[model samples]
Target: MGVSDTNYQIVYRGHHLEYFHPGGWVFFQRPKEAGGGFWLGRTYDFVFMIELPRPVSLREGILYLQQLKYESAS
Candidate 1:
């Protein structure tokens, strides 16, 4: 199933934490934090689901998201 088959929502604004679900999987981006401008949250859902090995950086998260799409393609 290509990523197109997988239901999801995407957020890019750097505002307060936002929540949105476009399909079976929920997606969210953690708001920026007070820790020296680094986002204390995430660009992808990590709080309520997706047991990540460790918190991923913005770039890493984006890359992983891309991979998710490709994987589904295969």
Candidate 2:
């Protein structure tokens, strides 16, 4: 499958988060000091982050993964 330039926005805690145009299998990297680490107290440190290709639903994510697999097989 080809890539899609779909985007999604998320708002939380009075903050607006924006993500750039994305395709399948999006990932967000959070800082270790900001709670993305393996520590216990800072578990909720990832306050703001966004993923690409925006999963409209669980089924959509599944389909996207399947498409990725198909593309890799080719």
lDDT of 2 by residue, 9-46 (tens): 22222332344333313323334455431111101234
Question: What would you estimate as the lDDT of candidate 1?
Answer: 0.44
RMSD of each: 7.2, 12.7
Q: Could you tell me the TM-score of candidate 2?
A: 0.30
TM-score of each: 0.43, 0.30
Worst 10 residues of 1 by lDDT: 34-43
Alpha-carbon local distance difference test for all models: 0.44, 0.34
lDDT of 1 at 12: 39
Candidate 1 per-residue C-alpha lDDT over 1-74 given as tens digits, one digit per residue, 9 for 90 to 100: 11245344434345433454422332334445622212222233344455355545555655666787799999
RMSD in angstroms between candidate 1 and the native structure over all alpha carbons: 7.2
Candidate 2: count of backbone clashes, pairs at least 3 residues apart or interchain = 0
